[model samples]
Target: MENGTNTQSEGKDPSGFLSKIIGNPVMVKLNSGVVYKGKYFTRELQSVDGYMNIALEKTEEYVDGTKRRSYGDAFVRGNNVMYISADS
Candidate 1:
């Protein structure tokens, strides 16, 4: 997990498929302590450029220590992801 580095090698499952069971909408925990809820999309198991692609649709919410914040639809790339978890 390099800072601002999106260099993923080939033959690697960049989507972290094993973390999600059936490609359902899950809570993805990012390195920034932000929990993003979105559906899993296609992954590149062998790509040097684009490692992963998630069609994430984030929501607007308010935290305890902060005011309301908003998020929108995104075509999130691979390097932006840290880890994913299914929302059970």
Candidate 2:
């Protein structure tokens, strides 16, 4: 590795299913019964950290099945996230 550059290839799906949903629409459900929707997830994916926390763009927040707010960017804490799926 020269100049701090190692010629290591990244896994095609290093983030597992997340690789499929980077730009697709998604629905994220939280344990508190709150839901967030965004432009996609791999079931549709954004960015997932080791702890499973997610960062999303163009997101909307929902409560009791009603749209409550919107965010240009949003972060979902891993512990609060119940599930994430492609928006269909």
Question: After aligning candidate 1 to the native by TM-score, how far in Å is the CA of 48 from where it should be?
Answer: 13
True-vs-predicted CA distance for residue 24, candidate 2, Å: 0.6
lDDT by residue for model 2 over 1-88, one digit each (tens)? 4587744554332364566667778888999999999864333244476667887779999999999999988878888988878786
What candidate 2 gets wrong by more than 4 Å, as runs, is 1-14, 40-47
Best by TM-score: 2
RMSD of each: 8.8, 9.6
Clashing pairs in 2: 21-45, 24-40, 25-39, 25-40, 26-40, 41-44, 41-45, 42-45, 43-85, 43-86
User: For candidate 1, lDDT tens digit of each residue in 1-88?
Assistant: 4586655652265344444344465665555555566544434212323444455555432244343555665454557667655666
Reference-based TM-score, model 2: 0.71
Error of 1 at 75 (Å): 2.6
